[model samples]
Target: MEITYTEAVILYCLKQLKGERTIFSLYHLYQGKKSSQTIQDAHLYHLTPFFQAFPFISREELARQIERMEKKSLLDKKSNEHFILTSTGDLKLGEYFQANTLPPKYLDGWRHHHLTALFWERLSILVQVCSNLVYQKKSFIPIQNKLETLDWVKAFIKKRQEGRMGLSSTLFLELLNCFQRDKTIDPSILVLRLTGQDRIGLTSGQAAELLGMDHTRYQLEFLNILHFLIGTVSDEAVEFPLLNALIPEAEKPVPFTLSTEKTFQLLNRGYTVEQISRIRNLKRSTIEDHIVEIALHIKNFDLAAYVPKDKEKRILEAAKETSAKKLKLIREYAEDASYFEIRLVLARNGDQKWK
Candidate 1:
């Protein structure tokens, strides 16, 4: 029997994890946990693209999926929770992938997760509105009902320099340009889900069935196209100007959690982790998480303030020598490095891949 898309994702994560972590690590990774450790795991395991790829999944659902894999001999349980992929499992995973079963190509859950859904919301509403306005029709239900999104759309349309005809044409051209630039993208995945004028868009399940895909398969494909558009429009704004304007400006700079942003502002004024903890009335460990999260996103963020340069170098060296990301393992090689110091270095190394 063919493995399902969800199973493939689990199998791929298991392979990347290399039996070092428990199956639940994949669970948290898929959920896109906001914790520092979960964020670090995403990069350390080279699973950044798949991070938060399945936020709707429940722990019970994950347990069921793992049970299914075990039944298929794709996974062998070790110590109750940890699992190592069996040879048959590895072979199956390879075969499944060889069929071009739609593994993620441009997911980028790390960079674009926060904005992907929002962009699609704005685009969907804009498309529906433009479709009706160009035809001189009024009084239609909006595709998005969130008050914030509704307000944003109204503001967006009012700010547009194009008339209904010009807006529709430019939007069409910009969208066409985005898909054409990414030759691998299949626009039909998006078009099939989009609604316009009198035509209501298909529900995700409806679209998936129509395209001969499982709902999960269609979700992954749709995310790929969405992220690709976000990346393309961001990088080549001059090319997709109309679409570029749709990107949320507030989130344009950084995608920090609200609490992390609060810490970031204090950090800008030079608060020590301890001081930030005191100021925020949170534990020191919690503040440390904020610091690590900062290092993960802000590439130029200074670490010398937290970890000595020599120590940072040693931690990174140990990481390279062992080819291991687990703090306990790297600690053995860098005997003098503290776990916090090791984490600080790894956070940067995970992204930069420094030698």
Candidate 2:
């Protein structure tokens, strides 16, 4: 069965999350939700970067798609807020992969990698240098102004030229072949146009104009192409040394604050939130916040200890009805629900408005 891009993305997200996920969590992963903290506080949740900029789909539209998929038996509602891929859904997802010439496992793994601002910065610089080198240009301005990044690129190009380590024309041809198989025109052109061949490549701005698109939109398309290329090549890194070399080695630190770590340690030791609050000299609300953050990041964290399953249902219902981010408003609808339970529901559901 054919699926829209949004449907495909949803199926892909559910598949990646191991075939079960709350709508909130799925949404968070799709759009790359960030933690509430400004300075990397303990309650902050680490988020993986996603291709949110290119897509015009909204949460409401996503919810509608989920409902439609469920009705079509492509998805099974495991609970009020959680969903799983049905056997039919799995088959449909498989079809999607086959149609796109993509490997499901690799796409899933790509979703988990932390694509940071620095990764994109390095990617832009690398693309520029590689493009110049491909065209046999002796000198060109680096995309990045940073000396360290320029030095790294220079060394990397030198190594490649010296036949030490780098991508070859054969690899570029393979990449182009892959791009040619894609449904969109921009992806192939973006790849070829960005990596110059016997001619200096166009800058992103020039490419955007040439493609009759705004610079920002063109950049988003460019990023989407780059992201797909990186993910696909990384999946076969053993065979594609050049693509593998471009993979960023820097790891993002776990999304836990020192205080949250203490809270998690205490909770693991069977300490109640109230007990931990007093022991740690922090407020009960603060401790609860830590638990919420923990639940958001750590899938195995036991939310049942704080909010019962029945209460969870009520919180979800209230949240859906009101669509309010404020704790006070949510509490009005879920009268018996404590602030902690409400927060837990919102966090698990990946509601960023409250945060």
Candidate 3:
């Protein structure tokens, strides 16, 4: 059986989850929900690489995919909202990936999504401008709409010592060198989306149709390429100066949601959770949610600050004993530990420390 790219992604996620999670947990993961449970689950399951990889996929659409997969005998319905992968499904997944490599390994969407998006926007406008300039054509509309990007392009180009022609050449050569270095990646999928002097770049759907690939597949491919470029450029910035310029700041471990970012700011200012809750006029539980979110992303966060060493040890032990990610399940075994403490432990260490 030929498993499609979309099927392959879902299958990979299901396998990682191992039916311990509800089907909708997959939905929330893709939707990139900011809830404490979803955020902790994304990290705990080791599925952070694909977090928010399909934010636009509707729940109904996901159900349809599951139904079709069930019909194909790739999924076994263990319950109304949970599924287990069949042995045949596992074999098929292995075969499918052997034939097609994808769902890029180092996505870090939970970490670099915002940075990736901004980098793409900057690259898009730069490409558009360079294309028009190559044809000696002016008066073309900018591909990027954000005022920040527009101003960035103006400021970026002005600051460059190279003239327009030299800048374009360097940009083109750097991109070529980077893409050419990776034989597994087909750069055409990405390049086809770039607007050139002769034509506007194709939309994602258009590019997918042209490539005879699924829309989801095309998107994953596109994102993988961006991540690939971001990684390539970051480490070799001196080699790809123009590419590195787009990512102006040192990347944060994970991009925080605005609310969580506010929480982080307070933590940085040496404010206690109770103090922040009162200052922000939010519930204590809500502030706790922010703290858990902080634990999930901030590597240096001291777990002992809120949780005593013994409680932390108990929670970790329970997670190992049961191999369960569910808070209720862990709470049952870790009777003395609260749900919040369990979450903090999971967020801090994820699956790595225990399992």
Local accuracy by lDDT, each model: 0.84, 0.61, 0.86
Clashing pairs in 2: 24-349, 42-257
The regions of model 2 sitting more than 4 angstroms off are 1-34, 37-116, 127-140, 154-166, 188-204, 234-241, 249-287, 320-329, 351-355
Candidate 3 — which residues are off by over 4 angstroms? 351-355
Residue pairs clashing in model 3 are none
Q: Mind giving the per-residue lDDT tens digits that candidate 1 earns over 157-248? A: 88888789999999999898778776877898999878898999998889899899878888889888988889888888878778988884
lDDT of 3 at 154: 87
Candidate 2 lDDT over 187-250, as tens digits, reads 5436435433344557777887777765544644666666566665666666556655665542
After TM-score superposition, the amount by which residue 234's alpha carbon in candidate 1 deviates from its true location, in angstroms, is 1.2
TM-score of each: 0.93, 0.54, 0.91
**Model 3 residue 293 CA deviation in Å:** 0.9
lDDT of 3 at 256: 74
Ranking by TM-score: 1, 3, 2
Q: Which candidate is the best by lDDT?
A: 3
Best by TM-score: 1
In model 2, state the lDDT of residue 335: 92
**lDDT per residue as tens, model 3, 48-76:** 77777888989999999999999999999
Model 2 reaches what TM-score against the true structure?
A: 0.54
Q: How displaced is residue 266 in candidate 3, in Å?
A: 3.1
Give the Å shift of residue 253 in candidate 3: 4.0
Question: Which wins on TM-score, candidate 1 or candidate 2?
Answer: 1
* Candidates 2 and 3 compared by lDDT, better number: 3
